[model samples]
Target: MTVSITDVARAAGVSTSTVSRALRGRPGVSDEVRAQIATVAAQLGYTASRSASSLASGRTFTIGVIAPYIGRWFFGTVLDAAEKVFSAAGYDVLLYNLGTPETRKRFFTRLPVRKRVDAVLSLLIPDEEEAAALRSLEVPLASTVGGAREGFTVVGIDDHAGAASAVRHLVNLGHRRIGMISGASEPLHWTTPLARRRAYLDVLADAGIEHDPKLEADGGYTVEGGEQAMTELLAASRPPTAVFAQSDEMAMGALRALRRHRLRVPDDVSVVGFDDHELAEVIGLTTVAQPVTGQGAEAARLLLEQLDAPDAEPPGHVQMPIRLILRETTAPPSPRGPQ
Candidate 1:
């Protein structure tokens, strides 16, 4: 015979409601109580019926993830991590890729994610209109790789601190003529990579280095865009001695450009990248390693917390740590470098 909540509660010496909350992994029950309830429920062959529970609680136990570009390595890595955690907790995930401006507008204004999931998770997504749409949903919301505003929970690296560390590393390595490849254009809310650029500029100014507009190029967060930007910077009369690409893929593209122009890395032009993607280690590229996978898991946890208590606490910012990985990609400039 299947064990019902009544049987589990009787065995665990708790109320039926407590047994239900403990089995569902919801708050209000202590970890010890939850463990005891689970042990008894397992011994009695108790299993939850999600459909019936949804009918009783009016919650789908699902989360909606909104990503601007799901194919990118950074976003993909984080999404995989989130999926693992949510699935393990018996929650479903719905992904929405807003690739075009029109689609983004529709998603925010018309077809906002509603009634489908109990909460929402956004990956490095930035837009005031979109934020407003999420606010209107009345569902718990969280973001990864960016800060939370207006009560939306967030889990991400401190971009300003991380960018400062990256630049300081290059400066300590005796590099003064440094350039940067910034992310795509966004004038509203500050995106992670965009904040990185600002941090770079602020650090350069503090170090008494000139911020050359010519050397700072826009990569548009694509390999081809990085290639084009590197090409333009290299063709300049006075090129930078070191370059910082916003993402690993962009740095890889810049590497290709350097090779085509007979510019040897660390000898002619040193390079650094962000995200510390898998290719970074393969190519021996120095970069800052953000906890992409861990960030995803933590974001899911935060969203679940909000779902349990919509009025528990206003969402706050969370900063995961970052580390600077030194590799063969960056070195001091040669006496006679590419000129």
Candidate 2:
């Protein structure tokens, strides 16, 4: 005979409602009590029917994760960490990645995620229309991208500050002609590329370096794109002695381009990149590192807290810190560097 929740409650010496909440990993049950209830339920062969539990609790126990691109290292890493946090809390994740603006627009138009999730987590800042659609979901909302939205509890790093540090490091090393492999144009709400580029220019101005259009190339935030950008820089009448790629992937590409040209790093062209990607250490690329996992986990936790007490907690922003990790890829340019 299949054991029921009531039988587990009786065996655990707790009320049926308490047993239900504890078994479902809901609030109002202490960890000790929850553990004991879980043990009792397992021993009694009690398994929950998700549909039935959702109907009774009026919650789907699902988190909708929205993002434009999952292939990027940053997005993939964040999603992995956030999924772990949600899984521990007994919640399922629904990914909403369509890979293009057209598809995303069409997906949001119908709002298929409506009433199907207990909370929402966005990996990208939604536009006004997208934001409106998300708000229509009427669920706890949080984000790990951009600054605080009107309704989202955000957890992310300061893009300007992080990028500025990378450029400033090159400037401190006496690199004047610093080229930048920049990300391509993005949507209005996707302001990371703009913020990082602005920092690069602003820092150069501070150090008396004149802006050169020839020094900037669109990398599209991919390895091949970055390699192409670096190749463009090499073709410049006067290539920069140091280069800053907006992402580590691009920096890796830049390194490839330099190697193909038989040029030595730092000795010929010092390179810096943002997002100290996992491969940065192994490849000896100097980069600005942000707490990618921390941001994702904290954003998920904030959403969970809001789910626990909807409309009780004020939405807030968490500006996580970033640091520059100096590695072998950067050094003062050789005296024979481009003039």
Candidate 3:
């Protein structure tokens, strides 16, 4: 026979309702009583039915995670770290990958995740329409790798600051003609690409460097895109002496492009990238390193806290720190090169 809640309650000398509250992690019971009830339930091999518990507590014991592309290094790392935290807390994860425009449209239109999770975690910033749809669900929401929305808690690094730091490094190395390979033009409200680009331009202006539109290229945050963008920049009448790629993958692509064109790195053009991917050290690529895993874990923790106490104070934003990693990829522009 299956062990029931009644049996556990009788063994622990508590009412069935008290056992239910304690087991569900609700607030009507003392810590000592809850611990005793858990111990008794474990000893008796008693497990509450999820359906019945959901009906009683109005919670699904699950979290819904939404991301653009999980295959990318940053997204993959963040999702993995967040999943570990949710699993340890006995919560299930439901992932939604909106990698294409069609999928994004379908997801926002249908909102299939409604009422299926205790909370939602977004790894990317949602557009206005998407944000509205998410808010309609009325669930606790949080984000990582994006700016704070009106109703959602956010955990991420300062994109503008990171970009500014990269530019400053290049400037300190005597690079005046700097170029940038930025993300593709989509998800205009995502803010990462926009903020970074704005900061890059601002830093150049402040440093008294002429900002040349011809030096900018769209890399789409990928290796192949970076290579293509770098090639285009090299073909320009006046190529920049230093190139800052928004991501490490793109930076690697720039290196390949330079080689293909018979242009030596640093010797011909210096390179810097953001998001210190695992290969950065192996390739000696200079980059801005942010706490990718830490941001995910912290976002998960914040959402869990909100779920635990919905009536608690409003959740605040978390800004993780970033640093510039110096490597062999960046140096003073060689005098032998045309400046």
Name the best candidate (by TM-score): 2
What TM-score quantifies how close candidate 2 is to the native fold? Answer: 0.96
Candidate 3 — worst ten consecutive residues by lDDT sum?
183-192
Full candidate order by TM-score, most accurate first: 2, 3, 1
lDDT: which candidate is best?
3
On a 0 to 100 scale, what is the lDDT of residue 144 in model 1? 87
Task: List ranges where model 3 is wrong by over 4 Å.
Answer: 5-48
How much lDDT does candidate 3 score?
Answer: 0.90
- The alpha-carbon root-mean-square deviation between model 3 and the true structure, to one decimal in Å, is 2.6
Q: What is the C-alpha lDDT of each candidate?
A: 0.83, 0.89, 0.90
Each model's total of backbone clashes: 0, 0, 0
Tens-digit per-residue lDDT, 1-339, candidate 1: 766789889988999999888878777999999999999988989888899789978989888998877887878999999999899888999998877777777788775568888888887466676677787888888888566577588888888777778888887777888888877573235477768988899988988888889888888777887888899889778898889888778888899999999989988888888888877898999998888899999999888777776678845888888988999989988878632
State in Å the error of residue 256, model 1.
2.1
Poorest 10 consecutive residues by lDDT, candidate 1 = 184-193
Candidate 3, 72: how far from true, in Å?
A: 2.4
